[model samples]
Target: MKKHIFKLLAFSLVALLAIGAQADDGFFSREGKYNGEDRGKPVMPTQLNATWKQECSACHMAFPPGLLPATSWTKLMTGLDKHFGADASLSAAQASEISAFLTKNASNRWTAKTAPLRITEAAWFKAKHNEREVASNVWKRPAVKGPWNCSACHAGADSGDFNEHGVRIPK
Candidate 1:
């Protein structure tokens, strides 16, 4: 009985967090609150620039700009030709616009001096997905592939709504 109660409580807590976060309509949420005001705030992409989406998503999911820092976006944009062992080169104009968008929306909580090229490499990412939370063999599963594939587990990943309540790890 005690074990069942504990599980129910845990599930309820997670559900509340997921729903409450999305329902927050504070002043910050009302306004186009960029500049890290909604940095750690639980919200989806309030505004997704079209150019960034079209260009970046052409190769892969245009990862939320908030996933990285300004410096990291700059570096990644500058080296688009050699993006992660692939030739994802973009025109100068496109790169500049996308860079500006990413930098403007970069993670407000990220304070590390080193800007990570991959979201998986970020310290916060590692902390959130530590060995204790995720089993070692989970990564080897064909469905999961690797940590970079956010949509593998997070159904709302494309929209940047990674609420834990909605996560469904693929079998």
Candidate 2:
């Protein structure tokens, strides 16, 4: 059963990737794609850089400032380890500090998903355009290395940022 599921997932991911190639051209115009309005600046006060480094930098690179709302970052930090793929354990003190920092700099506070590496939430479904379960499972696979390991394929991932022009995927 596991093997069959993995195979199905792999097939699904491949199909999604092929589709994503075409999908990118118009991904921005879709409904859930953030249009950069309404949201204010990140919640994390810019001065809280120290907290961000102490907490978030250890795992997936610090999120691009434009990506999530301040509220979302607050929610995500409070729920680390339960995070997408890895376990990022934090002491209570550390958690508190990081949470404060993220709430200041997160996406919810901003207008939209800024500098996002992947299409999330509603935009995700549109981008997937029917290829959902398989791609999600594939992301859970060892080969794909979690959904947010955007650095693996996207150029300049280590720069602590993401941009559409940098995207590249295997054929």
Candidate 3:
């Protein structure tokens, strides 16, 4: 009986220690919440696709693939003819390549089951840029433009660096 009890206690202690270690490593935050690896981290993929960069940036910024999920990317890619009221269609080969890259690098850490078409429509984006965080009038500024224009405030937005510390609200 003593041996069994000792073994059980030892196992419990080890399990607790492992949990604590993982929490410290950011899997579970100190506040007992599942923070995950993506929280407040840049979403850029190390290997960028040249075709995606060139085509997507022709009209607007080439958003990082991690901004949306695979499903959203698929939806957007298939509807290029009516893309945001503009014809942004690409060749079949180009579309396939960009689709693969975007899906592969899509938001793996997004907790929400939803697949938002626009990055600005994501729950995480709304929470970060809520009214309390950003003044309503700020968006109306000629230089600031709107939420879609991330580069207006985030200097390194093109590179996937949206850290608040580096943000500069344009006049």
Report how far residue 8 has shifted in candidate 3, in Å. 22
Ranking by TM-score: 3, 1, 2
Q: Model 2 scores what on Cα lDDT?
A: 0.53
Encode model 1's per-residue lDDT on 29-78: one tens digit a residue: 22333222223343235877899989888866789877777788888888
Give TM-scores for every candidate, taking all chains together and pairing residue i with residue i. 0.72, 0.50, 0.76
Candidate 2 backbone clash number: 16
Per-residue lDDT tens digits of candidate 3, residues 2-71? Answer: 9999999999997787687564433444455653333323468888999999999997799988777778
* lDDT for each residue of candidate 2 in 1-171, tens digit (9 for 90 to 100): 999999999999977865774343323445434344222332223454666665666766565543455556666666676766678868888887877765555544234444332324535323533354334455556655755565655566555434556655432
Note the residue pairs that clash in candidate 1.
none
Off-target runs (Cα >4 Å) in candidate 1 are 1-44
Please give the distance, in angstroms, between residue 61's alpha carbon in candidate 1 and its true position after superposition.
1.1
Give the Å shift of residue 24 in candidate 1: 14
Could you tell me the lDDT of residue 80 within candidate 2?
72
